[model samples]
Target chain A: DAGVTQSPTHLIKTRGQHVTLRCSPISGHKSVSWYQQVLGQGPQFIFQYYEKEERGRGNFPDRFSARQFPNYSSELNVNALLLGDSALYLCASSSLFRDRVTGNEQFFGPGTRLTVL
Target chain B: ELKVEQNPLFLSMQEGKNYTIYCNYSTTSDRLYWYRQDPGKSLESLFVLLSNGAVKQEGRLMASLDTKARLSTLHITAAVHDLSATYFCAVDTPLVFGKGTRLSVIA
Candidate 1:
């Protein structure tokens, strides 16, 4: 079974430009989450979509948005990108069960490296 | 707001040595995860610890969680050069991560 996959291994954009990163979840996974990992820092959660609905969001600003498709693939878009937005964008997929007691193991992708010049 | 902290942001040890990484979170959460990442690579799941006193081990790495103290520990036993990487502990309140611990196992 293939793991979560992300596209455009590397991207270069300018300040005030817009960029979109895509992710395809593993088979049978229903939830997709986006994260931004700055160099030398841990990943920060941006958005989480479960069953095509926004389930959670992190401290990111409105410039960051994400949506999940019926097939559990997702796209993360950043508008008016700033120099601070340069980082590796990661995507993770998991099966969110109804019961909270179960531990959902998130599978991550080889994040897309975004650079704002 | 929840916050996660990892102690010893960096670790350097010779092969066959042992070390442990600590993770402390501000809020209560039962689900904790350990992930390893090589330079310029994505994260690889190491352990998923759920509930108080949950412990899991794989090869030379072991992870334990204490929900009461909101702490988790990743212990590396007899470390090898191949184990050199950054390790991160995350609390699954939808997943919040701590500053990773970069481990360099010298051979």
Candidate 2:
């Protein structure tokens, strides 16, 4: 079984441009979450989608948004990107039931490195 | 608001030595997790501690959680160079994470 996968391994955008990162969850996984990891810092949760609905959101601003598809794939979009938004965007997936029973030991992708020039 | 704090933000140790990383969180949560990440790579799940006294071990790494004290510890036993990376502990609710502990196991 393939693990979670992300696309566009690297991206460079301008300060006012928009970028979208994509993620495909592992087979049979129903929950997907987005995180932003700054250099030298742990990942910060951005959004979590379960069963195609927004289940949780983090401290990120309105510029960040995400949506999950029926196949459990997800897309994270950042609008009007700022220099502060330059970071690695990570996508994680987990089985909702298993996550609830156990802790959320989410499987993560290699992440999309976004750089705002 | 859940806040997670990790101690020894940077750790440097020789091979065959032992060290411990600590994670303290504010607020009550039943789920805690530890993850490892190599430079420029994504996170790899290490341990998922769900109970008050949950302990899990794999290879030379061990993780234990104490919900009462809202603390979790990752212990490295006889560390090896292969174990060099950043380790993070996270709380499940809203999925808050610590600053991470960067461990360098020198050989």
Model number with the top DockQ: 1
Off by over 4 Å in 1: A97-102
Per-residue CA lDDT of model 2 for B37-106, tens digit only, reads 9999999989989999899999999999999999999999999999999999999655789999999988
lDDT of 2 by residue, A12-36 (tens): 9999999999999999999999999
Let me know the DockQ for model 1.
Answer: 0.83
- Return the top candidate by lDDT: 1
* Candidate 1 positional error at B37, Å: 0.6
Span of ten consecutive residues with least summed lDDT in model 2 chain B? B88-97
How far residue B11's Cα lies from its native spot in candidate 1, in Å, is: 0.6
Per-residue C-alpha lDDT of model 1 across residues B49-77, encoded as one tens digit per residue: 88899999999999999999999999999
Report the CAPRI category for model 1: high
RMSD of 1: 1.1
Error (Å) of candidate 2 at residue B85 is 0.3
Give a tens-digit lDDT track for model 1, residues A1-117: 899999999999999999999999999989998999999999999999999999989989999999999898999999999999999999999888333655888889999999999
